[model samples]
Target: MRGFISLLLLTLGLCLQATGMAADKSVIAVIVTNDNPNKSISLGELKLIYWRKKTYWANGQRIHPINLPPDHPLRLQFSNSILGSTPSAQNDYWNGLYFHGISPPHVLYSDEAAIRYVQETAGSIAYADACKLDNRVKPLLWLLPNGETTTNPSFVNCN
Candidate 1:
Protein backbone atom coordinates (compact mmCIF):
# COMPACT_ATOMS: atom_id res chain seq x y z
CA MET A 1 0.00 0.00 0.00
CA ARG A 2 2.85 2.42 0.82
CA GLY A 3 4.58 1.76 -2.55
CA PHE A 4 1.39 2.33 -4.49
CA ILE A 5 0.77 5.64 -2.74
CA SER A 6 4.32 6.83 -3.53
CA LEU A 7 3.95 5.92 -7.20
CA LEU A 8 0.65 7.76 -7.48
CA LEU A 9 2.13 10.90 -5.92
CA LEU A 10 5.09 10.81 -8.32
CA THR A 11 2.79 10.43 -11.31
CA LEU A 12 0.65 13.32 -10.16
CA GLY A 13 3.63 15.56 -9.70
CA LEU A 14 4.93 14.82 -13.19
CA CYS A 15 1.53 15.39 -14.73
CA LEU A 16 1.21 18.75 -13.00
CA GLN A 17 4.63 19.83 -14.18
CA ALA A 18 3.78 18.92 -17.79
CA THR A 19 0.52 20.82 -17.60
CA GLY A 20 2.26 23.93 -16.24
CA MET A 21 4.72 23.89 -19.12
CA ALA A 22 1.91 23.64 -21.65
CA ALA A 23 0.00 26.49 -20.03
CA ASP A 24 2.36 29.00 -21.60
CA LYS A 25 1.13 28.01 -25.02
CA SER A 26 -2.50 28.49 -24.10
CA VAL A 27 -2.73 32.24 -24.86
CA ILE A 28 -0.59 34.74 -26.76
CA ALA A 29 -0.72 38.50 -27.29
CA VAL A 30 -0.17 40.21 -30.56
CA ILE A 31 1.89 43.20 -29.41
CA VAL A 32 2.85 46.56 -30.85
CA THR A 33 4.23 49.81 -29.58
CA ASN A 34 1.79 51.90 -27.61
CA ASP A 35 2.36 54.75 -30.05
CA ASN A 36 1.15 52.69 -32.97
CA PRO A 37 -2.15 54.17 -34.15
CA ASN A 38 -3.93 50.94 -34.87
CA LYS A 39 -5.97 49.85 -31.90
CA SER A 40 -6.86 46.45 -33.29
CA ILE A 41 -5.86 44.23 -36.16
CA SER A 42 -7.73 41.67 -38.23
CA LEU A 43 -6.66 38.11 -38.92
CA GLY A 44 -6.28 38.80 -42.64
CA GLU A 45 -4.13 41.86 -41.97
CA LEU A 46 -1.98 39.88 -39.57
CA LYS A 47 -1.45 37.24 -42.23
CA LEU A 48 -0.42 39.88 -44.75
CA ILE A 49 1.90 41.65 -42.33
CA TYR A 50 3.72 38.49 -41.33
CA TRP A 51 3.98 37.28 -44.88
CA ARG A 52 5.71 40.56 -45.84
CA LYS A 53 2.84 41.17 -48.22
CA LYS A 54 1.96 44.35 -46.38
CA THR A 55 5.08 46.48 -46.29
CA TYR A 56 3.73 49.56 -44.59
CA TRP A 57 1.18 50.50 -42.05
CA ALA A 58 -1.78 52.54 -43.23
CA ASN A 59 -0.11 55.63 -41.81
CA GLY A 60 2.82 55.17 -44.24
CA GLN A 61 5.36 54.07 -41.66
CA ARG A 62 7.13 50.92 -42.78
CA ILE A 63 6.01 47.82 -40.98
CA HIS A 64 8.62 45.88 -39.06
CA PRO A 65 7.57 42.44 -37.92
CA ILE A 66 9.49 40.54 -35.29
CA ASN A 67 9.55 36.80 -34.74
CA LEU A 68 10.83 34.40 -32.11
CA PRO A 69 13.06 31.48 -32.99
CA PRO A 70 11.51 28.91 -35.31
CA ASP A 71 10.94 26.21 -32.72
CA HIS A 72 9.80 28.41 -29.85
CA PRO A 73 6.26 27.59 -28.74
CA LEU A 74 5.05 31.21 -28.95
CA ARG A 75 6.45 31.55 -32.45
CA LEU A 76 5.08 28.25 -33.63
CA GLN A 77 1.69 29.28 -32.38
CA PHE A 78 1.94 32.67 -34.09
CA SER A 79 3.22 31.26 -37.37
CA ASN A 80 0.55 28.62 -37.49
CA SER A 81 -2.08 31.20 -36.71
CA ILE A 82 -0.95 34.22 -38.73
CA LEU A 83 0.81 32.51 -41.59
CA GLY A 84 -1.62 29.64 -41.84
CA SER A 85 1.36 27.29 -41.95
CA THR A 86 4.16 25.85 -39.84
CA PRO A 87 7.51 27.62 -39.54
CA SER A 88 9.34 24.98 -41.55
CA ALA A 89 6.81 25.15 -44.35
CA GLN A 90 7.03 28.93 -44.46
CA ASN A 91 10.77 28.71 -45.02
CA ASP A 92 10.17 27.58 -48.57
CA TYR A 93 7.93 30.54 -49.23
CA TRP A 94 10.46 32.96 -47.80
CA ASN A 95 13.21 31.43 -49.89
CA GLY A 96 11.26 32.05 -53.05
CA LEU A 97 10.58 35.63 -52.00
CA TYR A 98 14.24 36.22 -51.14
CA PHE A 99 15.10 36.92 -54.76
CA HIS A 100 12.46 39.62 -54.87
CA GLY A 101 14.04 41.49 -51.92
CA ILE A 102 11.53 40.30 -49.40
CA SER A 103 12.67 38.82 -46.06
CA PRO A 104 11.05 36.92 -43.30
CA PRO A 105 10.37 38.53 -39.95
CA HIS A 106 13.49 39.19 -37.91
CA VAL A 107 14.02 36.43 -35.34
CA LEU A 108 14.57 37.28 -31.70
CA TYR A 109 15.62 34.91 -28.93
CA SER A 110 12.67 35.23 -26.53
CA ASP A 111 9.30 36.76 -25.89
CA GLU A 112 11.00 39.45 -23.85
CA ALA A 113 13.33 40.27 -26.68
CA ALA A 114 10.51 40.35 -29.17
CA ILE A 115 8.56 42.69 -26.93
CA ARG A 116 11.55 44.94 -26.48
CA TYR A 117 12.11 45.05 -30.21
CA VAL A 118 8.53 46.02 -30.85
CA GLN A 119 8.61 48.70 -28.20
CA GLU A 120 11.74 50.27 -29.64
CA THR A 121 10.67 49.99 -33.25
CA ALA A 122 7.65 51.89 -34.42
CA GLY A 123 5.18 50.19 -36.74
CA SER A 124 6.44 46.88 -35.41
CA ILE A 125 4.52 43.88 -34.17
CA ALA A 126 5.19 40.54 -32.52
CA TYR A 127 3.49 37.88 -30.46
CA ALA A 128 4.38 36.86 -26.93
CA ASP A 129 3.03 34.68 -24.15
CA ALA A 130 0.25 36.90 -22.83
CA CYS A 131 1.17 36.23 -19.22
CA LYS A 132 4.65 37.60 -19.78
CA LEU A 133 3.45 40.93 -21.12
CA ASP A 134 4.49 44.29 -19.72
CA ASN A 135 3.28 47.88 -20.13
CA ARG A 136 6.01 48.72 -22.60
CA VAL A 137 3.91 47.34 -25.45
CA LYS A 138 0.24 47.22 -26.35
CA PRO A 139 -1.57 44.04 -27.21
CA LEU A 140 -3.59 44.21 -30.41
CA LEU A 141 -5.06 40.79 -30.09
CA TRP A 142 -5.24 37.96 -27.60
CA LEU A 143 -5.14 34.65 -29.39
CA LEU A 144 -5.52 31.01 -28.44
CA PRO A 145 -3.03 28.35 -29.41
CA ASN A 146 -5.12 27.56 -32.51
CA GLY A 147 -4.86 31.27 -33.61
CA GLU A 148 -8.45 32.17 -32.87
CA THR A 149 -9.19 35.18 -30.69
CA THR A 150 -10.42 34.45 -27.20
CA THR A 151 -14.19 34.76 -27.17
CA ASN A 152 -14.10 36.47 -23.81
CA PRO A 153 -11.52 39.24 -23.37
CA SER A 154 -12.05 39.13 -19.62
CA PHE A 155 -10.82 35.56 -19.54
CA VAL A 156 -7.33 36.74 -20.60
CA ASN A 157 -6.07 38.78 -17.70
CA CYS A 158 -2.58 39.58 -18.92
CA ASN A 159 -0.30 41.56 -16.73
Candidate 2:
Protein backbone atom coordinates (compact mmCIF):
# COMPACT_ATOMS: atom_id res chain seq x y z
CA MET A 1 0.00 0.00 0.00
CA ARG A 2 2.85 2.39 0.77
CA GLY A 3 4.47 1.74 -2.61
CA PHE A 4 1.18 2.27 -4.42
CA ILE A 5 0.63 5.60 -2.64
CA SER A 6 4.17 6.76 -3.56
CA LEU A 7 3.64 5.82 -7.18
CA LEU A 8 0.36 7.72 -7.33
CA LEU A 9 1.98 10.76 -5.77
CA LEU A 10 4.87 10.63 -8.22
CA THR A 11 2.50 10.33 -11.15
CA LEU A 12 0.54 13.33 -10.02
CA GLY A 13 3.72 15.36 -9.65
CA LEU A 14 4.85 14.43 -13.13
CA CYS A 15 1.49 15.37 -14.56
CA LEU A 16 1.66 18.78 -12.94
CA GLN A 17 5.18 19.29 -14.22
CA ALA A 18 4.11 18.44 -17.74
CA THR A 19 1.22 20.86 -17.54
CA GLY A 20 3.54 23.63 -16.37
CA MET A 21 5.90 22.99 -19.23
CA ALA A 22 3.03 23.16 -21.69
CA ALA A 23 2.00 26.50 -20.27
CA ASP A 24 5.49 27.91 -20.68
CA LYS A 25 5.65 26.60 -24.21
CA SER A 26 2.56 28.62 -25.03
CA VAL A 27 4.39 31.91 -24.56
CA ILE A 28 6.69 33.12 -27.35
CA ALA A 29 8.64 36.14 -28.54
CA VAL A 30 7.68 38.11 -31.65
CA ILE A 31 10.03 40.66 -33.15
CA VAL A 32 10.61 43.31 -35.76
CA THR A 33 12.63 42.71 -38.91
CA ASN A 34 14.82 44.65 -41.28
CA ASP A 35 16.87 43.93 -44.40
CA ASN A 36 20.10 44.80 -42.63
CA PRO A 37 22.35 41.96 -41.50
CA ASN A 38 22.68 42.71 -37.81
CA LYS A 39 21.91 39.71 -35.61
CA SER A 40 21.01 41.07 -32.17
CA ILE A 41 19.37 44.08 -30.61
CA SER A 42 19.85 45.34 -27.07
CA LEU A 43 16.83 45.88 -24.86
CA GLY A 44 17.45 49.60 -24.70
CA GLU A 45 17.71 49.89 -28.45
CA LEU A 46 14.52 47.90 -28.91
CA LYS A 47 12.65 50.21 -26.57
CA LEU A 48 13.86 53.26 -28.42
CA ILE A 49 12.82 51.77 -31.71
CA TYR A 50 9.35 50.81 -30.51
CA TRP A 51 8.66 54.05 -28.72
CA ARG A 52 9.64 56.19 -31.73
CA LYS A 53 12.56 57.61 -29.81
CA LYS A 54 14.82 56.11 -32.49
CA THR A 55 13.72 56.04 -36.10
CA TYR A 56 16.53 54.38 -37.89
CA TRP A 57 18.14 50.99 -37.93
CA ALA A 58 21.82 50.48 -37.11
CA ASN A 59 22.59 50.76 -40.83
CA GLY A 60 20.83 54.12 -41.08
CA GLN A 61 17.75 52.75 -42.78
CA ARG A 62 14.38 54.17 -41.85
CA ILE A 63 12.58 52.40 -39.03
CA HIS A 64 8.85 51.67 -39.10
CA PRO A 65 7.34 50.14 -36.00
CA ILE A 66 4.05 48.33 -36.04
CA ASN A 67 1.69 47.94 -33.12
CA LEU A 68 -1.28 45.85 -32.04
CA PRO A 69 -4.74 47.07 -31.14
CA PRO A 70 -4.96 49.00 -27.89
CA ASP A 71 -6.50 46.11 -25.98
CA HIS A 72 -4.38 43.17 -27.14
CA PRO A 73 -2.49 41.30 -24.46
CA LEU A 74 0.77 41.33 -26.38
CA ARG A 75 0.37 45.06 -27.03
CA LEU A 76 0.05 45.69 -23.32
CA GLN A 77 2.95 43.35 -22.68
CA PHE A 78 5.16 45.15 -25.17
CA SER A 79 4.21 48.59 -23.89
CA ASN A 80 4.86 47.63 -20.29
CA SER A 81 8.01 45.74 -21.07
CA ILE A 82 9.62 48.03 -23.58
CA LEU A 83 8.25 51.46 -22.81
CA GLY A 84 8.00 50.92 -19.04
CA SER A 85 4.57 52.50 -19.26
CA THR A 86 0.93 51.51 -19.18
CA PRO A 87 -1.49 51.86 -22.10
CA SER A 88 -3.22 54.91 -20.69
CA ALA A 89 0.10 56.55 -20.06
CA GLN A 90 1.27 55.69 -23.53
CA ASN A 91 -1.89 57.09 -25.04
CA ASP A 92 -1.34 60.34 -23.21
CA TYR A 93 2.27 60.39 -24.26
CA TRP A 94 1.31 59.88 -27.89
CA ASN A 95 -1.31 62.55 -27.68
CA GLY A 96 1.30 64.92 -26.41
CA LEU A 97 3.68 63.89 -29.16
CA TYR A 98 1.00 64.28 -31.79
CA PHE A 99 0.19 67.77 -30.65
CA HIS A 100 3.75 68.69 -31.54
CA GLY A 101 3.41 67.14 -35.04
CA ILE A 102 5.28 63.99 -34.00
CA SER A 103 3.44 60.92 -35.21
CA PRO A 104 3.36 57.84 -33.05
CA PRO A 105 4.08 54.30 -34.14
CA HIS A 106 1.61 52.87 -36.61
CA VAL A 107 -1.03 50.70 -34.99
CA LEU A 108 -2.43 47.53 -36.53
CA TYR A 109 -5.66 45.71 -35.84
CA SER A 110 -4.27 42.20 -35.33
CA ASP A 111 -1.08 40.22 -34.96
CA GLU A 112 -1.42 38.73 -38.42
CA ALA A 113 -1.72 42.17 -39.98
CA ALA A 114 1.24 43.40 -37.94
CA ILE A 115 3.34 40.45 -39.08
CA ARG A 116 2.42 41.03 -42.68
CA TYR A 117 3.28 44.72 -42.41
CA VAL A 118 6.64 43.93 -40.87
CA GLN A 119 7.41 41.30 -43.45
CA GLU A 120 6.64 43.61 -46.36
CA THR A 121 8.04 46.86 -45.01
CA ALA A 122 11.72 47.50 -44.62
CA GLY A 123 13.09 48.17 -41.15
CA SER A 124 9.83 47.34 -39.46
CA ILE A 125 9.31 45.97 -35.97
CA ALA A 126 6.29 44.28 -34.41
CA TYR A 127 5.33 41.87 -31.65
CA ALA A 128 3.21 38.73 -31.40
CA ASP A 129 2.67 35.78 -29.10
CA ALA A 130 5.34 33.12 -29.50
CA CYS A 131 2.90 30.34 -30.26
CA LYS A 132 1.75 32.21 -33.38
CA LEU A 133 5.16 33.19 -34.72
CA ASP A 134 6.03 32.28 -38.28
CA ASN A 135 9.31 31.93 -40.17
CA ARG A 136 8.74 35.18 -42.02
CA VAL A 137 9.86 37.45 -39.21
CA LYS A 138 12.39 37.28 -36.33
CA PRO A 139 11.93 37.98 -32.66
CA LEU A 140 14.12 40.63 -31.01
CA LEU A 141 13.28 40.44 -27.31
CA TRP A 142 11.18 38.52 -24.87
CA LEU A 143 9.28 40.42 -22.18
CA LEU A 144 8.93 38.74 -18.84
CA PRO A 145 5.97 39.19 -16.54
CA ASN A 146 8.09 41.40 -14.27
CA GLY A 147 8.73 43.77 -17.21
CA GLU A 148 12.34 42.65 -17.67
CA THR A 149 13.73 41.55 -21.00
CA THR A 150 14.80 38.05 -21.94
CA THR A 151 17.07 38.62 -24.91
CA ASN A 152 17.28 35.92 -27.53
CA PRO A 153 20.75 36.03 -29.05
CA SER A 154 19.82 33.70 -31.90
CA PHE A 155 17.40 36.16 -33.56
CA VAL A 156 19.54 39.27 -33.81
CA ASN A 157 20.02 39.15 -37.55
CA CYS A 158 16.40 40.09 -38.38
CA ASN A 159 16.34 37.02 -40.60
Candidate 3:
Protein backbone atom coordinates (compact mmCIF):
# COMPACT_ATOMS: atom_id res chain seq x y z
CA MET A 1 0.00 0.00 0.00
CA ARG A 2 2.82 2.44 0.87
CA GLY A 3 4.64 1.71 -2.41
CA PHE A 4 1.47 2.27 -4.45
CA ILE A 5 0.85 5.59 -2.74
CA SER A 6 4.40 6.79 -3.49
CA LEU A 7 4.08 5.79 -7.15
CA LEU A 8 0.79 7.63 -7.48
CA LEU A 9 2.29 10.76 -6.00
CA LEU A 10 5.23 10.55 -8.38
CA THR A 11 2.90 10.21 -11.37
CA LEU A 12 0.88 13.20 -10.30
CA GLY A 13 4.04 15.24 -9.90
CA LEU A 14 5.23 14.30 -13.37
CA CYS A 15 1.91 15.25 -14.91
CA LEU A 16 1.99 18.64 -13.22
CA GLN A 17 5.55 19.20 -14.39
CA ALA A 18 4.64 18.38 -17.99
CA THR A 19 1.69 20.71 -17.95
CA GLY A 20 3.81 23.52 -16.58
CA MET A 21 6.42 22.98 -19.28
CA ALA A 22 3.83 23.19 -22.03
CA ALA A 23 2.32 26.34 -20.55
CA ASP A 24 5.74 27.89 -20.60
CA LYS A 25 5.87 27.73 -24.39
CA SER A 26 5.16 31.13 -25.92
CA VAL A 27 2.06 31.79 -27.99
CA ILE A 28 2.74 33.96 -31.06
CA ALA A 29 0.43 36.75 -32.13
CA VAL A 30 -0.01 37.76 -35.77
CA ILE A 31 -0.77 41.45 -35.97
CA VAL A 32 -1.85 44.17 -38.39
CA THR A 33 -3.12 47.70 -38.20
CA ASN A 34 -6.73 48.22 -37.13
CA ASP A 35 -6.73 51.64 -38.72
CA ASN A 36 -6.77 50.13 -42.21
CA PRO A 37 -10.57 50.63 -41.99
CA ASN A 38 -11.05 47.15 -43.46
CA LYS A 39 -13.12 44.38 -42.11
CA SER A 40 -11.60 42.22 -39.39
CA ILE A 41 -10.15 39.19 -41.12
CA SER A 42 -11.26 35.69 -40.34
CA LEU A 43 -8.78 32.87 -39.98
CA GLY A 44 -9.56 31.70 -43.51
CA GLU A 45 -9.17 35.22 -44.82
CA LEU A 46 -5.85 35.56 -43.04
CA LYS A 47 -4.66 32.29 -44.60
CA LEU A 48 -5.68 33.52 -48.02
CA ILE A 49 -3.81 36.76 -47.54
CA TYR A 50 -0.67 35.05 -46.28
CA TRP A 51 -0.80 32.40 -48.99
CA ARG A 52 -1.08 35.06 -51.67
CA LYS A 53 -4.52 33.90 -52.74
CA LYS A 54 -5.80 37.35 -51.84
CA THR A 55 -3.52 40.25 -52.65
CA TYR A 56 -5.51 43.30 -51.73
CA TRP A 57 -7.23 44.72 -48.68
CA ALA A 58 -10.91 45.70 -48.80
CA ASN A 59 -9.83 49.30 -49.27
CA GLY A 60 -8.16 48.35 -52.57
CA GLN A 61 -4.74 48.74 -51.06
CA ARG A 62 -2.18 46.13 -52.05
CA ILE A 63 -1.55 43.67 -49.24
CA HIS A 64 1.93 42.65 -48.24
CA PRO A 65 2.25 39.49 -46.17
CA ILE A 66 5.51 39.22 -44.33
CA ASN A 67 6.89 35.80 -43.48
CA LEU A 68 9.44 34.49 -41.04
CA PRO A 69 12.57 32.55 -41.91
CA PRO A 70 12.02 28.96 -43.03
CA ASP A 71 13.33 27.38 -39.84
CA HIS A 72 12.20 29.98 -37.34
CA PRO A 73 10.14 28.61 -34.49
CA LEU A 74 7.42 31.20 -35.03
CA ARG A 75 7.31 30.33 -38.71
CA LEU A 76 6.82 26.64 -37.99
CA GLN A 77 4.17 27.47 -35.45
CA PHE A 78 2.43 29.82 -37.86
CA SER A 79 2.48 27.28 -40.67
CA ASN A 80 1.08 24.50 -38.53
CA SER A 81 -1.48 26.59 -36.72
CA ILE A 82 -2.69 28.91 -39.46
CA LEU A 83 -2.19 26.97 -42.69
CA GLY A 84 -2.72 23.46 -41.35
CA SER A 85 0.50 22.60 -43.19
CA THR A 86 4.13 21.82 -42.56
CA PRO A 87 7.11 23.88 -43.71
CA SER A 88 7.67 21.59 -46.69
CA ALA A 89 3.99 21.71 -47.56
CA GLN A 90 4.05 25.49 -47.43
CA ASN A 91 7.08 25.47 -49.75
CA ASP A 92 5.22 23.22 -52.15
CA TYR A 93 2.21 25.50 -52.08
CA TRP A 94 4.40 28.51 -52.76
CA ASN A 95 6.14 26.66 -55.58
CA GLY A 96 2.82 25.86 -57.20
CA LEU A 97 1.86 29.50 -57.02
CA TYR A 98 5.22 30.59 -58.37
CA PHE A 99 5.14 28.19 -61.32
CA HIS A 100 1.78 29.53 -62.44
CA GLY A 101 3.02 33.13 -62.68
CA ILE A 102 1.45 33.92 -59.34
CA SER A 103 3.85 35.24 -56.75
CA PRO A 104 3.86 34.06 -53.17
CA PRO A 105 4.02 36.55 -50.36
CA HIS A 106 7.38 38.13 -49.66
CA VAL A 107 9.53 36.37 -47.06
CA LEU A 108 11.64 38.07 -44.42
CA TYR A 109 14.65 36.74 -42.55
CA SER A 110 13.60 37.58 -38.99
CA ASP A 111 10.60 38.66 -36.95
CA GLU A 112 12.14 42.06 -36.42
CA ALA A 113 12.42 42.54 -40.16
CA ALA A 114 8.88 41.38 -40.72
CA ILE A 115 7.63 43.78 -38.05
CA ARG A 116 9.65 46.61 -39.49
CA TYR A 117 8.33 45.96 -42.97
CA VAL A 118 4.77 45.89 -41.75
CA GLN A 119 5.22 49.11 -39.81
CA GLU A 120 6.61 50.86 -42.85
CA THR A 121 4.13 49.46 -45.35
CA ALA A 122 0.42 49.96 -45.11
CA GLY A 123 -1.89 46.94 -45.55
CA SER A 124 0.92 44.74 -44.33
CA ILE A 125 0.66 41.96 -41.73
CA ALA A 126 3.21 39.96 -39.74
CA TYR A 127 3.71 37.73 -36.70
CA ALA A 128 6.10 37.86 -33.79
CA ASP A 129 6.52 37.20 -30.11
CA ALA A 130 3.94 39.20 -28.19
CA CYS A 131 6.58 40.44 -25.82
CA LYS A 132 8.49 42.02 -28.67
CA LEU A 133 5.51 43.89 -30.06
CA ASP A 134 5.75 47.66 -30.14
CA ASN A 135 3.49 50.62 -31.00
CA ARG A 136 4.40 50.37 -34.66
CA VAL A 137 1.93 47.61 -35.58
CA LYS A 138 -1.25 46.00 -34.28
CA PRO A 139 -2.03 42.32 -33.65
CA LEU A 140 -4.45 40.42 -35.86
CA LEU A 141 -4.42 36.88 -34.53
CA TRP A 142 -3.16 34.71 -31.72
CA LEU A 143 -1.99 31.20 -32.65
CA LEU A 144 -2.07 28.24 -30.30
CA PRO A 145 -0.37 24.84 -30.41
CA ASN A 146 -3.64 23.02 -31.13
CA GLY A 147 -4.54 25.47 -33.91
CA GLU A 148 -7.01 27.29 -31.72
CA THR A 149 -7.37 31.03 -31.19
CA THR A 150 -6.39 32.57 -27.93
CA THR A 151 -8.30 35.35 -26.19
CA ASN A 152 -5.13 36.54 -24.59
CA PRO A 153 -3.71 39.55 -26.41
CA SER A 154 -0.13 38.66 -25.46
CA PHE A 155 2.27 36.10 -26.87
CA VAL A 156 3.45 33.28 -24.66
CA ASN A 157 7.15 32.53 -24.37
CA CYS A 158 8.38 29.18 -23.11
CA ASN A 159 11.97 30.20 -23.20
Using TM-score as the measure, the top candidate is 1
Name the better of 2 and 3 by lDDT.
3
Q: Give the alpha carbon lDDT tens digit for every residue of 35-110 in model 1.
A: 9999888888888899889989999999999888988877777777667788998878999999999999899998
Task: Give Cα-based local distance difference scores for all models.
Answer: 0.85, 0.71, 0.76
- Which regions of candidate 3 are displaced past 4 Å? 1-24, 151-159
Model 3, span 54-95: residue lDDT tens:
889877998888888776777777887788886777767768
- The model with the greater TM-score, 2 or 3, is 3
Q: Which candidate order results from sorting by TM-score in descending order?
A: 1, 3, 2
**Which residue runs does candidate 2 get wrong by more than 4 Å?**
1-28, 153-159
Candidate 1 similarity to native, TM-score: 0.81
Clashes (backbone N, CA, C under 3 Å), per candidate, total: 0, 5, 7
Error of 2 at 159 (Å): 24
Writing each residue's lDDT as its tens digit, candidate 2 over 29-129 gives: 64666454656678778778776889987678898888787766667667766777867777777887887887887889887888788888888877776
Number of clashing residue pairs, candidate 1: 0
